[model samples]
Target chain A: MIVARTGNEAMAEAMRQVNPDVVAAYPITPATEIVQIFSSFVHDGLVDTKFVAVESEHSAMSACIGAAAAGARVMTGTASQGLALMHEMLFIAAALRLPIVLCVVNRSLSAPINIHCDHSDTLASRDSGWIQIYTENSQEAYDSVIQAVKISERALLPVMVTIDGFIISHGMERIDILDDREVREYLGEPPKRPNLLDIDKPITMGPLDLQDYFFEHKRSEIEGMNTSLPHIEAVAREYKERFGRYYPVIDTYRIDDAEVAVMAMGSAAGTAKVVVDRMREKGKKVGLIRMRVVRPFPKNYLKELIQGFAAVGIMDRSDTLSTLGGHLYVETRAVLYRASHQPPIKNYIYGLGGRDISLEEIEEIFEEVLEIGKSGKVTEPVVYKGVRE
Target chain B: MPSLKELIKKQDLLSGGHRACAGCGATIIVRQVLLAAQYPVVVGASTGCLEVVTTIFPYTAWKVPFIHSAFENVAATIAGVETGYRALKEKGKIKEEIRFIAFGGDGGTYDIGLQALSGAIERGHRMLYICYNNQAYMNTGIQRSSATPYCAHTTTSPAGKVIPGKPQFRKDLTEIVIAHDIPYAAQASLAYWNDLTKKVQKALEVDGPSFINVLSVCPLGWGVPSDMTVEIARLAVETCFWPLYEYENGKYIINRKPREKKPIEEFLKKQNRFRHIFRHPDRDKIIARIQKEIDRRWERLLKRAG
Candidate 1:
């Protein structure tokens, strides 16, 4: 069905259709409406989800872990500090191999305590062993959440699907949603594993692994992430076949024939694409690579994608605070180290703490990259874009 | 209620040869609770003595379904499991009736896990939460916990020249849980196996959340011989240091009222943790204070039971 809905509404609508067996959540801003709306759905009997109005985000994630371990299709929504609060359990969920689908509306972390759009919150948790998929807008947010369920289950890894806070969460846009029956059919039955609830064949979960087997167990977990790309691609392909839209881990726009390309994620990719189109109309060879899945790093795809570009500019909405540039810049730079012909990649840290990154600013970045592309010379590897010095 | 023979004959869900120390009261409590459980059960243990000893990787003491997900969240975790079971059962995916139980040490219950326990109880998940109250953080080598009794010397709240021992009284967690207005909440002792198992059965039979705080004895942490675990626990009940009581259907019930409550020293003198108080210059004063507190609490319970 075609409907005009906010990103939060879209995610909630998808959650309703997914009709998860359990959803334990605590509310936080920007992501609050998703659970609020879903809880109302539960009250109205629109879905059979067991909604737990937990007291805190820590319990919310902890509950999700428990439900997931109990062999139920489980999901929850949180953002910013809520995600930060769920930090420890996030690693445990991944380690336990429980495929919990977490919907994250991207927002800034605290210091000055801002509840605004930024990648800092999710970016800080990049090493938490969760499969992170950044969405460009409400439509993608709606689609990615459903896809995340399948990907997470297929790969036996928890998936974090994020849309920019307020920009997409509170902003309304036209999005096509799958019918409830279609979603039900697409997902089929919740995948079965040796769960905690199995009465006869009893199993022990989250056992204390000392030095003897902790390393081997962690190695297997790493291997789970390593070989998960195929599982991700398989689900995306199946979703495309079932529905008309398709989303890849590395989403590219006009990057095939461009001399200068820019990398962006979440909503910034939308603005970058508009600039890419505008620059293309004026005969500027510029392109965009939107990172959908950040964890497991998409190393091979990234390597293949950046092969021919003369110069690439990476747009990061959150700074690493390490003076080592942003997360994407450092990761993308590292991924290109083994490339035969390396591009002079510059990092543009922009739109931090919900600050807007204008198309004109993106155009300016493309212009700089285009200059570097033509000159075959590099300068200023990291620039804090759109913020006054 | 089932007789001791009948209860023991039902099932031995906890396998033998676990790594728990000798006379660990937490394991005894676990066995009683699991044996009393009528339906198919899934158990959760917090990161404490019971969890570490029972669920070491590749070897588990549990013969029934078990999960140990970090300390301080076992209540929340079991709430989720119960909810999950409900959802699955409603969906026709799960057929059998399954009871959920979470076992947390006092440190995981009265201290760090207090919030999660409160939340779980308030939400009223149909699960039984048991706190093995062994006084201190026994799993972490006798650190001070809110559950540790006043004048008991733990590693963190050690008795010194300037200070007596743990300055504050132990948290009344059973009363705190009762404040949540849950259907069943109780205090039990391992010395009274029948009472402990009966309370577990009562808790598991409740349609809403239930909690039982068992007086678990740790020989190593409490500075007692392994053989004195049950005897020391009995002394606690006999002296009114740990009352045997329950809150059910909005009424308080003192399960066992001693004919003549003994002095607190009978319980305290047996353990080295309280030895400093017996030898201190203010020994009479400290002992009087401890006895007064217990008397005050017991009187309050008697009034509530009326």
Candidate 2:
């Protein structure tokens, strides 16, 4: 049954449904409620799971890796510097194919050291071999976590479900949560892979791969990721069938017959969607495309989706290789490289380091997209609605 | 009387054919520890010489369920694993008896990993953490670590005209672990396999967190011949440089003692890292001071064990 709950409660309920055997976590702001509510379940005997109170974020991820390697369903939550501290093990977890599911309360990486919402933390760990999914709100946070576990176990790759810190992690909202039995039947039992700890059939995992075999091993990881596309869609379909909530890997809001589309992710997409709705009411042919799965690229899907658009304004909270380019712009261009009907893409680097990306700012970005479509070559990178120097 | 052999499991959890360097004391210690553990044991290994050598992608040497976490989180990882096992057992999901053990190098345990180790012990988790004290970071090309003995040459702390080996003395990780007042803490070496095995078995039998500091000799790091690894470790104990002892419930017990104490130079002469000390007579005073410090610590341990 659907119950109105906050993101943290939705996450906790989803974890209860997944029934992870071990939950090792340390409390951090924004991510604490996820663990706090889960701990209550452990205390009340609502869930038969071990709740480890680790000393630091490093230990939290380490403990999860250990439990996961030992053939137990393991989950943990962290943010910002905590995610950075767990960076090394994240790669190990993926390489080991442990199927660990991590809920990342997305926080800004340090420098000015803000603890609020941003995509930089998860963005920095893009190449860590984890299948990353960005959630726009509490409902997505809960729903995506269940989907993440199914995808990770099926692909034999770890998954990270990211919700913007404070914006979605701390923001209270009504979210639908499926019953434990329904979730159990939907996700089924975690697929039995060759675990590191199985005594009867002993298998060695995480072996040293020198230059000779390292390439092949890396290629296999890529193969596993490539294989995840169908499995992720299948899991999402299963979730929708069981719980009556639909979520696509890439959710397009009013993009059909549109001249301009704002591409973004996380809670910023919510604001962008509102701006798109307002622009549509004013007789403007603009829409929003929210990227759900950031990793495994979804290049082919994006190429198909952006085929008929006149101009695509890619809004990113992260910078890419080029000074003026954003990560979204780079991926979008790479996906649309040989397409016949590729749109003229404009890069907009905004909402970095937890700075507010309000609805007004999204409107301003939409205005830039309109101006750029008319001019053809308006400006390089066009830092839209940026904080004035 | 229970036979010491009966205390060990017949199954070889950490098998052979791994890519550890020849005469690797750390590899031997891991095997010994695994043999001493009961069935359904979970192992948490830190990133070190043994971990890097054994777990290379899709090829593991470990027969038991093992995890290789970051350098600083082995103890904490094991503690969490133990907690999971406890919860599972209480819920009747896990019916078999299980033990949790963590392994780390001196660089990981004595320095970078100390905080996590401290937290695990303080939390009183049922696990055993063994620090294979190989003196330096052998995995990372023989860099200087806090466990490197004073007057010993390393890649980072090389003996030169201006500087003669590492200036700081080795950190006493055994004493530091013991100070936490855990039920069990000990120091062992590769030279005494039976004693090391017995200590591991005893640590596993304990209900709370136990720490073992093993003087694992690294031939390549110390610039000694691979064949002399065992002899080098033996001389270390005979010279009283690494005392073999155990602390149980506030009581100190020396497990082994040399019948005839050897001179520090005998141990120093085997390793090329310390060869410079003997060549220069001006460094005699430094060697003498190190010898004196070893002697003092040994006397203190003996008195406490009494």
Candidate 3:
């Protein structure tokens, strides 16, 4: 069915079709409407979902851990401070190996309390052991929520589906939503595991381990992440065949033989895609790559995606507060080191606190990358896009 | 409800092979609560000694489905499980009746876990949250908690040169939970098995959220001899220091009131934690103040009960 809906509404729409056993969440800006709308759906009997309106996001994720541990397909949504509040439980959700789907409407973390779009919130929790998937538009946002359930459940790890808070969550767009029956059949029954609540075969979850087993458990978690990559690819393939929506680890646009390429994640990628087309029309060899599955950190796909580029401009919506650049920039550089070919990569930090990055700014970034391509050297590996200094 | 003897015989859900401390009142409370539950239960424990000692990988004593989540949020975790059970039952998935119970230490319930507990109760999930109050954070080695009583000596509230013990009185967490206006809330003690078991059964039977603050004993944390766990806890109830009461449907009922209340000194002197107050320069003054405060609180509770 085709409908005009905001990203939050579309996520709620997908949730209705997936029909999880329970969803626990606390209301927070930008992401609040997702659960609020889902609660209304429960009230209207649109879905048989148990909506747990928890007082805080910490409880929200904690509840998801319990529900998911009981072998129920569980989900929740949060943004910014909500995600931060859930930080401790996020690791527990992963370590307990429960497949709870978390929708993160990416927003800036607070000091003075900003509610705008930034990758800081999710990036800060990147090591929480959740499979992080970024979406560029409402359609991908909707699709990710559905596929994330399968991925997380299959991998026995929690999944975080993120989109820019104000940019995508509140912005309305026309997209094709799956038929409820199709979605139901596609998801089918949630796979059963030995549950914490199962009376017949009781199992213990999240026990303390000091020296004997902590290392082994962590190594096993690393194995869990390694095992999820193929599952992600397989699910994406099945989704493409069923819904005609294609999502690879990285979405490459006109990068086949480009001399200069720009990298973006989430909504900024769409804005950069427009600039990519404009630069190509002007006879400039500039392309764009939108990274989708960041948690598994598809370094090889990224290395392969930027294959023919001489100079690449990596646009980071959030700064990592580290020595040189953002998290994506550092990881991208490190990954490309083993790629058999190293491109001169320049990092561009932009769109912080919902700061708008116009097409002209993106065009200028491509021009910079082109200049770097000519020189074959990146004098400034990191540049603040719109900052005064 | 099962008779005390019958309940004792019912397969011990918390098995014997686990490693709870000797004369651990919290573990006994867990066992009794499980005995009274009518439905098959899934137990959740906060990150504490009970959780750490019981399910230390490859040697879990929990015969029933048990889970240990983060230290705080045990209530939230069980609330979520209860929510899932409702959905599953509605979908014709769960046929048997299942109950959810969460256990937490004093620190887990009264301090960091407070918000999550409040949220879960306010949201009205059908589950029983049992706070095994041992006065302080016994899990992390007896640091003073909000549930730690006044003038109690803990690691954080050491009775040293300038101070007595924990300076302030313990926060009334039972009243705090009652403030949410949940379906049922109560205070019980491990020593009062009949009263505690009855309250646990009623809590499990409640259709909405229920909370029980079980004033449990801790040999290590409370600095009492292991054999004195029961004696100390019984004296606590007899002295009105930890009253046995219940609140249901907006009405309060004092379940067990001592015919003649005993002196608070009996309860205080049994524990080494309170050993210092007896030798302090102002010993008489402090002991009288403690007795007077207990008397005042007991009278206030009686007025409410009346």
Candidate 4:
């Protein structure tokens, strides 16, 4: 049914439909309402999930890992520092191959300590062997979470579904939610894996590995990610076939015949789309590419997408502070490296700590990229967009 | 409760031939607790001597379903496992009854993991959290932990020329756990197998979260011979330095009160960690202070247990 819901509301509704076996989470801003609403569902007996009101985010992720390893469908939500607190357990979860779903409301990391929307939290955890899916709006957030359960289970790797804090988490938008029975039918029964709860065939998990087998075990985990691309695509395809909304790893708009393109992720992609349409009406050959998945880097599809464009502007909500630009910018550049025709890509670090990214700034960015496309050269590679001197 | 003969007949959950140091009290404590559990149990261990030694890769001493998460969150991890079992059983997925237990060293339990333990118990998970209190961090080279007794020498809190051994008193973790008002909380010693096993059985039988602090003795960390682990542990109880007690349903029960408490020097002089206390210039005053503290605590415990 079509209903107006914020991103957090959409995620909570999806979690309710998923009706996981256990949810252990601590409260954090923007992401707190997702677990808060789900806990009420558990309280009202809408779902038979055992909601663990853990003391801290560290325990929240630890419990989720324990629950998932015990062979239960598990879900939790956190943001910024909460995700940062869960950093150590995140690697353990991925290394152990527990299919736990974490809903992250993207927020900036500390120092100045702002709870506003930024990609620093999830971006910093990029190498932690998780399947990261960034959503553009409330609808995408709802769809991606439901899809993440299937992907994580199939890949045997944990999945992180992120929405921009406050922008999507608090802002209400019209979204279509699937029926509860339909979601259950789509998800089907939980897989029977070798779990800690098994009595007759008892198994040991998360044991210490020394030099003898640690490298080989890590290599196998890398192989799990290496071979997960098809599983990710297959889940997205089946979800589209059943639910009628398709979300690919790399989604594009008006990029069929464009001289210049702007790449973005998360909620700002929605703003970029409007700017793209306005620029197109003004007869400027410009388009937009929104990256949905970041973890299993989507190198091949990204290379194919950025093939013909003379120049591209990459928008990053979080800076690496390494002077090498933001996470997306650095990774995208690495992915495009060694290509026969290298596009002069400019990195636009914008909207950090939830500073607004307006249409005017994006239009200016497109104009600069369009100029770069014309000259086939780049003067400045990395620009801290919209920041005061 | 099973007799000693019956318990011995039960399958050994923790297999032998692991990498633990000889006479490691934590391993013995684990064997005793697992033997006492009547139901099929899923065990979790925080990063510590028990975890690293028992479950080295390519070889795991654990015969039961086991998990070793990070250092400070085993209580939370097992709480999750218990919650998972409940959820699954409610869904008619798991039919059999399975108990959950978590093991942590003194460092994992009293210091870094204390918050997680408190939270798990307060949330009322039906699991048993056993802390193998070896007084210090035994796995990472004898560092001082909050559970280290007063004036005990550790690598971090050495008996240097300036300041003696560990200056602070050990944290009474069992009392702290009792304040959570859990269904069962107890202090047991590795030397007393019967009392330790009985407490484990009682803890596993409780309907809500239970905690047992087992006073584990580390031969390496305590600077004692491998064969002296249990004897040193027994001296700790006899000297009234570490009492055997239990708190259940708002009642404190002193299980083993020494008939005539031994002098603190007997317990202190056996280990090299406390040897510095003997040769120090203020040795008499230091010994008196230790005895005074032990007497004061023992009297308070007797008053409560009465």
Candidate 2 local lDDT, B24-85, one digit each (tens): 99988887777666556767788888888888766788877776667788887677667766
lDDT of 1 at A166: 91
State the DockQ of every prediction. 0.82, 0.53, 0.80, 0.89
Q: Rank candidates by TM-score, best first.
A: 4, 1, 3, 2
TM-score of 1: 0.98
TM-score (chain B) of candidate 2 = 0.96
- What are the per-residue Cα lDDT tens digits for candidate 4 across A1-389? 99999999999999999999999999854345889989999999999888999999999999999999889999999999999999999999999999999999999999689999999999989989999999999999999999999999999999999999999999999999999999999999878889988889888999999999999999999999988888889998998899889998898999999999999999999999999999999999999999999989999889888978999999999988898988888988998885777889999999999999999999999999999998988888998999996
List where candidate 3 sits over 4 angstroms from the true fold: A29-31
Q: Indicate which candidate wins on TM-score.
A: 4
Determine which window of 10 residues in candidate 2 chain B has minimal summed lDDT: B1-10
Reference-based lDDT, residue A154, model 2: 88
lDDT of 2 by residue, A1-389 (tens): 66777777778788988888899888754345788888989899888788888888888887787677666788888888888888887887887777889888888788678787767889889999999999899999998998888888888999999888777777788766676787888777667666544555655445556888999888998898888888889988877777778889899898886787889998889988888889989999898999999887898889988887777889888776466477778878888888988677887777776788878878977887777677766456556447676
Give each model's whole-structure lDDT. 0.91, 0.82, 0.88, 0.93
Model 4: residues with Cα > 4 Å off, grouped in runs? A29-31
Clashing pairs in 2: A197-B65, A207-B55, A207-B56, A207-B57, A208-B55, A208-B56, A208-B57
Model 2 misplacement above 4 A: A1-4, A28-31, B1-22, B38-42, B52-65, B80-84, B87-93, B257-261
Docking class of 3: medium
Write out fnat for all predictions, comma-separated.
Answer: 0.72, 0.51, 0.81, 0.84
How close to the true structure is residue A285 of candidate 4, measured as C-alpha lDDT?
Answer: 94
